[model samples]
Structure formats: C-alpha cells, structure tokens
Target chain A: MVHLSGIKAQNLTEKGVKTRMKILETAEQLIGEKGYYETSIAEITVKANIAQGTFYIYFSSKKAVFDELVYQLSSDFRYHIKIAMEKEDTFEAKQRAGFLAFFEWVTKHRNLYSIVQQAVVVDEKLYRAYYQKIAAGFITSIGKAMEAGECKSLNVETVAYCFMGVGQFIGMRWVVWRDQLVPNDVFEEAMEILFNGLTHKGGKKNWRISRTGYTNEQ
Target chain B: MVHLSGIKAQNLTEKGVKTRMKILETAEQLIGEKGYYETSIAEITVKANIAQGTFYIYFSSKKAVFDELVYQLSSDFRYHIKIAMEKEDTFEAKQRAGFLAFFEWVTKHRNLYSIVQQAVVVDEKLYRAYYQKIAAGFITSIGKAMEAGECKSLNVETVAYCFMGVGQFIGMRWVVWRDQLVPNDVFEEAMEILFNGLTHKGGKKNWRISRTGYTNEQ
Candidate 1:
C-alpha cells in the first residue's frame, strides 16, 4: 500500500527517469542472478555504467532500490496479465491468456522467481504484499465468473489462491527449472484440470479419455 | 537421486544416533526460524545441549547438516502423505487425504515454507531435488491411477505438478499465512476445482453455480 513507484515523482527530467530505469533494470538482473544479499549498489552502478553518485540520485540506498524493483516487478506483471486478458472474449479465455502472459513475462524476466522468493527473507511484508496484489486481481475476475455461473460457487479467494498456485508451480517446474516454455500438451492438461477438474463427465463415462490416451476420473 | 540423505553413514551406537537426531532437530528449528546463513553450528549444538565437537561426529559441516535437514523434511512429508492416503480407497480420496496431510504437517512445522525456500539460495540442487522427490511420488501414484482408469488421461507429469502446485499454494495461503487449518468449506471448494474444474455440469450448464448465491458463466 505504500506509494513505491520506484522513482522520485517530482523534479524529474526525462533523462533522469531513463537513468533511474536503467539502474533498476540492471539491479533486477544482478539481484536475480547473484541475490540481494550479495548484490551491492556499486555493482548495480557498475553494471548500469553510471557513476556511483548517479545511482544515489535515483535511489536512496541499496535496500531502497531493491524495494522499488520489487514494486515494479509486481506492477509490471499485473499489467501484462491485464493486457493479455483484455484480448480474450470469455472469462475462461481471459484466465488462460492471463496465465500465458505470466509465463511469457517470466520467460523474459527470468530472475522473477529468484527475486520474489528472496523477498521472503529480505522483506517479509514486501513478499506477502506481492502475492496479495496478484491474488486481488484473481479475486476480482473470479468473483465476476462466479456471479455469471461460469466458475463453481466455491470460496472465490480460495479459488484464486488455487489458480495462482497451479500457475506458479507449473511455471517453476517447466519454465524456471527446464528453461523452456510449458509444452502445449502440458499447458492444455493443466488447464483441463483447472477448468473441468479431474472428475469424469457424468456416470456415462468411467473416465475422461484425453487425447494423450489416459483416462481421468477425479 | 544423488543420495543426499544429510548425515554421514558411519558406525554409531544407539546413543550416537539419538544425539545426531537431536542435533538435526535443533538445526531444523533454528534454520527454519533464522535461515541457513544466519544459523551456525555452535547455536545448533548449544540448543541440542551437545558439545560443539560432537557435531562433527554426526555431520561434516554446517552445510552438511542443512542438507540433511532438507532431506529429512522431504522424506518425512512423503511418509505422512503416504500414510494418510492409504486410509482412502479411491484416487480422489487419496489425493484429498494427501493434501490434508500436507496442510496439517505444515501447520505443525511452521518453518517448512522458509526452510524449503531457503534451499533455493543455499543449495539449488537440494531445492530442486526436494520438489523432484515429491513429484516422483505423485507421478508414480497418478500413473497408477491413470492405468486403473480412475483419473484423466493427460500428461502424467504435468498433472503431478499441477496437483503439487495447487496443494502448495492452497497450503501456503491458508495454513502458512493464516496460521489455521484450511476451513472445511474452503478445502472442499479447492478440491472441487481440482477434481471437477471451474466448469459446471453438462453442456447444458455453461458454468458452475457457486454456493455464494451466484451463477458463473466464465
């Protein structure tokens, strides 16, 4: 809830904003690779190819800069998801698009997982706030779906976390660990589990036979 | 797979084993509370009421003990899930039980999230191995369920991660964050989403009707 836009709002020339962003981007990459504890302002400035004094002009300190990066990461992610979801016609489509956006964004910003996870240790409040922000986005959309009879009448918040968790674990498993996009079949299977669940359709069938030649009856 | 069982395999008396376990328990507690880098062997030994020199007899160094603790946490968790799942007859029931076991276990072992997450920074291999071990367990069981026509025919590994992700996020949300058992209704809702998905019954029903007195069509 703190107003942390990652840059000073007042008295900023266009070039100053650009320099500040450069410093942040450099910090994000380094912190993601080397870790927050190991990274320093000097390193960030060096990587940004700016004077150490220039770094101070954009941020107060190393911790301050780190906080800004966290704020930006969370904001940027939600923005991407929102934009991706807007292109979809239905709620389900929107949800899928949102997930795909997350994966694609993470693929480019590879340090996201590392940096976010580190927030747990570096700043617990920031860590919780990051997920809470994302959950809020899910809650609003899921609430709408529940109202329209598209999603089950379960607790919306619980469903939000469930959806978030599934995306997170799947992303970590394939994207982060394997350094690849989630395979199409894998993504589809996960979505099926999310949309239709593991249960078979009606007593008419013993199990849902997916294209992969497996039977599922949740 | 790399045989990271944590402690050195050496000849020891019953008392030595007990002593070693005491050290591990103390270390697990401290590391979980304070983090791996912040915790030290002296603190663990002192907490365990053993001599600092006694530590080397059981483990080689601080990292060794940390690795051992990670191994134990994973093993103990699988054991709990297996035992809980055995009480259920169907795969679906087994999964619910497994998730319940996880939530219960994490509730009791509050440091679980921190400790396992810390492994990402402390030892990336150990962290990956931890999840991989859990996934392997799920894969084997889900594979069995698929063969028996009790579950859907999807990519088994993807399904395994999906299940893991759901349980983890759900647990993290309710048990870890809230410091309470997942409310029965909340748990049931999540299970419904996992087993039946967000979609409502039959093609006639476009989306599920939530008990929250709303119909969803997303």
Candidate 2:
C-alpha cells in the first residue's frame, strides 16, 4: 500500500533524478501556497525551469504529480520518525521521539499541512491513504507495546488514530500556525495528558496552579 | 469572535429566511461533494431551483455563501454540544456528552468534514476561525474544570487542542470514512483512554486479550 519511491524516478540517470526532484519540489511549493485548483501546470513547469513536455515525461497529469508529492512527503517523514524511534529503548520514549521527529520534519516541510489538507478537496482517496498509512505504522508499534504490557490493551486501531490526532493537532497549533517549534512546556503538557490522563491522581502537585495562578482547593 | 447568526441574515421575513436557507443548504451539499472550486453558483441555484439573481439576495458571491455555510455548521454543532454538556454535572461527563453531541451532529452532516477542509485552501482565515471558535468553547469549559480540581492542571489551551484532535480523528475514522455511527464499544474505549490514560494499571483485566485471543502474562 505504501510506495517508497517517486513515480518515475526509478532507473533514471543522475540528471533525470535531479530533474524529477526539481519538478516535485516545485509542485510542492506552488500547490502548497496557491492550492491545487488555483495552481496551473504551466506555473509549475515555469517555476521548475523545465519545458511543458518535460513534465509529461515525469508525470502524466497535474493530479499525478500531486499524488507523487504526497507519497514522497509521507515516506520522508515516516522514515525520519522510524529512525528517531530506533534511538529509544522504551515504548513511551520511542513514541515521544517519534513525535519530535514529526515536528522537526513538519518544521522543514511546513507546506505538509497545507498539501495534505488540500488533498481532502483535490483527492479524498489520497488523503485517506496518507493518514491510513501513518495509522498503520502507529498500530504496529502500539500493538507491540500492548504485548509487552507496557501500554493499555485498548483497541489498536483506535489508539493509533488517537495518537495521530494528537500529533497532528499539536503540530498544527504550534508549528503550522505559529511557525515556531512547539515549546517544551506545551509538549510536556501534551505528553502528560496522553500518559497520565486528565483526571487529577492526587500525588502530583497541580502544575497550572503555580504557572497560571489558579487556586486549588486540595 | 463567534457570530451565532448567519451573515446578513437579520430582519428577514419568513419567506426570505426560507429562500436564504435553501441557498445555504444547496451550497453545502454541492460544495461538500464536488468541492468549492468545482461547484459553481449557477449549479447551486439550479439545484436549489431558484433564479440566478436570487442567490445574490442571500450572498454576494460564491465565497460568501461558503463562509456562511461554515459559520452555520459551526454554530449548529456547538449549540447541540452546549445543550448536551449542560445535561451533565461533572466535567468528565460533560466532555463525554460533548463528544457524543458532535458525533451525532456529524452523522447527519457528513459533508462537514469536506467543506471545512476545503476552507484550508478557499479561505485560510475562515478555516482557522472555525477551529478557533470551537477551541474557545473548549477552553472555557476546561478552564473551569481545572480551577475546580476536576481535571489536571496542565495548560488549558494544550488540553483543549488535544481534546479537539481526539474528537476529529475519531469522527473521521468512523463517521466520515465508514458512513456509520461510531460503535458503542469504540465510543466506550475512547472514553476510557481519555479518562483513565492508556497505561495499564494493576487492577482491570486486559480487554483486548479476551477479545482478540491474545494471552497476557500478567
């Protein structure tokens, strides 16, 4: 279900690979900024510094290029996250690392949010595929944690989607909207909610009481 | 920042209001299905069985109608959630009710996911406003819970976004994709994860072990 490589870049010369990369990058920027419907193939070709016919050599149509861009971006981020997760020993630590990797990748490709959201309108199937692939990865790692008794035995698919939602919304609020790295405090608070749940468990001090001047009765 | 009523909807006669609603409803169905750019005003009017000039009575442009549709949908769901939350006494129960209200609302307005997503491209500010309005409501409710010590004392905004993410992804996974209500077990599992955290504490039996035939050592 996952295609790890570009659409037509296989068996290409070094120059052909570069040209293909150029086209994909250009499409990413234009489509990311102007949107799919508003962006024209001519604009992509001009921005890519390639002839119109050259685009056809790499992709059959505008939608084809857009699909490849989504695929490449998904693969790139997942690879980075997988590498980051490998450096951690425990499931919680690995999950945290994976999230950090996602934020870092999104910081570099800020257009990722825009492009993926645009897919909802441009191609609904592609949009679903993008998240389904991410959820699949999460389900696998979370399933392992459950087997090890390191995590709760909730439905694997449900947990996977929940985790994806956290990563996406947190990234959207801090990185995408503010154009800044998620502050450490915000990240820790999110982790706290995910790990400890929102119910006050009595042992820990109330963090917001000191930080936000909220009075706690107990 | 929240506009409870529709744009330019004030002081209209009963017949005027009905005509206006017809335009918004038609716009929602078409935009939800074909997307914003692909769906034309002419098509909306045709489907609505109204004259082309009649659309101008309610909206100035296609974008105007789209903005109103977003506003109307946001208002509709928030109103329903507010009523649902009011019926509950505790913060946790209120939140659970809110999620239920949102899910029920989305079941009827399935195009909501697509239309709001399209706002990411059609009008970024409107898209942001949509979630921000929803977040504002969440923050107010969550803040009260934190103050009363019913919830953890983490950053209010962080908690708000996390809750929003959970609602959105869970809804998208079940209601939007599958075109069915979120199943009872799935709903209960989500509530458990939200209320109790995902770490398996010592007492409760592992639910998935029995359901999936996986043996748990502990």
Candidate 3:
C-alpha cells in the first residue's frame, strides 16, 4: 500500500550496517537459489560466515529476513529504474531505458522473479504490496507523461499494468527463462508493438490482412 | 522443451477417472491455498475424504500430482481460449474473446497463477514448459494473425510474449491481486493500447505534445 518501507530503517554503526547488508545479500542469494521455505536462518548465517546468533541482531526471524529481502529488492528495483529513466530525455526513451534497466537488474539478481513470486504463497500482503509499490512508480511516471501529452488518454492504471506486463514477461521470457540477454531486435520489435501496435501503418483499417499482404473483406 | 505431456494419460474405469479428477481438483485448491511445500499427501487425501494410500494409485508422489495439475491447468486454459476465440469473427475480436476467456478461467481457477508460479521453485523444468506451451499457443495464433495481415509484422516470438505479458499482469493486477473481475473500461483501455498503443491516434507525430494538446517544437 505504501511506498515499500523496506525493513525498519535500522540505525547502526558502519560495521553493523555492513554486517547487516552482508546478511541480507547472503539471504537474497540463498533464498533465491533454494527458496524461502528451504533456506533457514542457520544456513543464511553459515553462508554469510557469521554466527547463527548474529542473525537475530538484524532480523527477528527467517520470515523477517524474507520480508526485508522482498522490500529491499523492490526498493533496489525502483531506484535502478528511476536512475535509468532520469538519464533519458523522452518519455518513450525513458521507458525503453527503464525496460533495459529492469532486464539488466533482473539478469544480475536472477532470483528476483522467483523470490518475489514466492511472496504470493509465503505472504500474500507482501506479494500485493510489492507489485502495488512498483505499479505506483509506473502510475506516477505514466500519469505525468499523459498530462504532458506524451501519450494517449487511456486509463493510466490500465496503461500502468500493461506497461508492467510487457516488462515482466519479456524479461521472464528471454532474461529469466532463456538465460540470455533480450536481443536488440527482439526489444525493438516489442517497442514497435507498444508504440504502433500490431496494426501496420498502411493497413490501419484491417485487423486481418492476408498472407499475401491483402486485407481480406471482413 | 517438449510439449507439456500433461499427466500420463491413464486408462481407468469411469469411477476411477472421477476419483482421480477429484484428487486433482482437491490438490489444486489445497496447493493454491496452502502452497505446495506446506501441503502433504496425507492432508490432501484427508481433505478429499480418501485413504492416504489411494492417492498413490492416482499419482506417484506429491510432485507428480503437482506436475499433472500444471499440465491440466495449461491444457484446460488453451482449450477454453481456443473455444472462445473460435466464436469471434476477426483476429482482434478473437484476441479480445481470448483475453476475456482467460480472465474468466483464471477467476474460477484462482490458484492458477500461484500454482503455476510456484513451479519456478518447485520444478523449474515444469515451470518453463508450462509457459512455453502457452507461448507456443500464442505464437501459432498470433503468427496466423500476422500472416493474414490481421496484425503487424513484429517478431512473432516477441509479439507472442508481449501478448502473454499483457494478459498476465493485467489479470494479476485486477483479478488475482484485487480479487475482482477486470473492469469493462479497464479491459477496453488495455485493448486500445494493444491495438492503438499509448500514442494518440491523431497525435502520432508528437512524442511530447503540450498540455494544450499542441505538438510543440522539440
């Protein structure tokens, strides 16, 4: 519901913050690789090379770590997207940069889709909040684009989800499933669909043109 | 990956088939509600009012039932979409009907997203194949649409995934997350974006039209 208030902002000594971050990074990798149910506090400590008791100083429980990880990942995701978009000059370009940044970030994290999706079963509220937060980012940026007349007047919520869907699935298909970068042509083609749609500029009236490029009578 | 060879087609008496179906339906609900790792075979049989050993007769293990459920859900999904699309007369209409049918089906099988997504962690291969099978269906349908000039010439695979993503995130946003049907207006707006894109039809040349709707100097 709120902008992902990631883990209670813990005030800690520099060393303490580093150790906490180490624990979080280790948990992210382990949970992403092995799953939340399978990963335990003991394992996270072991993997982080810290004592089991040390984990409690940071996170209260394994579920707490998972929640914090989701929040952290969500925060990191939006931050990266915002940074990428800021470098672009146009709304369309910003979107392209955002998509590119998303693919890049997910490629590095690799466990993002798996870990975040697990929230659906692991914690329903967290699952919803995670996406709602991300969609909020989309809604704001998109609403501005519409107001600036950079886009159409279609419902912004609908547009936001559609935008999110395009990014999510394309990243899932190439970056996650295939373990490959989204090739330039593939990315461009998808952009074309987003910008111009499946209807060719010339064949605007027909939704079904023939194999030989003829618009058959409907 | 091979086509989803959904649960080995077993020859059984009519009563046996019905009992098997009952187990599957029960498993779908249980897994969707409680998640795969938490739900046990004993719990499943108990909930279904069957002997624990009887579940083994229908499925070799908990994983087997999960796999079969994924297969069954995918098969049922495609069948329904095919039927709904067939009833429509044009490619666009067929896509609209297909999306509508998909929303309706997922609404009924509310666990479809959760169960299928869990496949990522439960069985990565099954998870990938489930989506691949669905994407294959999209590719074939969208390919035909493109060939017939019903749609544009964007890369079919990219187009297929884009199509898949839109349906997925939109469904997740309204149906899965909100626990409600996708509103008619929202659905229509999404359709408009798909066919016409985020760019206004008349303002196609403007990437940054002013608040006054003027396609101003860049």
> Per-residue lDDT for A172 in model 2?
91
Over B130-172, each residue of candidate 1 has an lDDT whose tens digit, in order, gives 9999999999989999999988888899888988988988887
lDDT of model 2, residue A182? 78
Expressed as tens digits, the lDDT of each residue in A1-218 for candidate 2 is: 22338445567887878888898898889888778999999999999899999999878999998999899999999998998788767787778778878887787888888899888878999999999999999999999999998998889998888888889999999998899777777887776677667785544332221221111112
Docking category of candidate 1: acceptable
Native-referenced DockQ of model 3: 0.39
- Candidate achieving the largest lDDT: 2
State the local distance difference test value for candidate 2.
Answer: 0.82
The sequence of per-residue lDDT tens digits that candidate 1 reaches over residues A1-218 is 21235346556777877788888889888888777777888999988999999988878998898888888888888887898788766778788878877887777787788888877777778888999989999999999988988766778898899899889999999889888777667777787888887867654223111211111122
RMSD of each: 7.4, 8.7, 6.6
- Return the top candidate by DockQ: 3
Model 1 misplaced regions, further than 4 Å:
A1-10, A203-218, B1-10, B203-218
Q: Quick one: ranking by TM-score, best first?
A: 2, 3, 1
Q: State the TM-score of the second chain for every model.
A: 0.85, 0.88, 0.87
Window of ten residues with lowest summed lDDT in model 2 chain A: A208-217
* Model 3 CAPRI quality: acceptable
TM-score of chain B of 3: 0.87
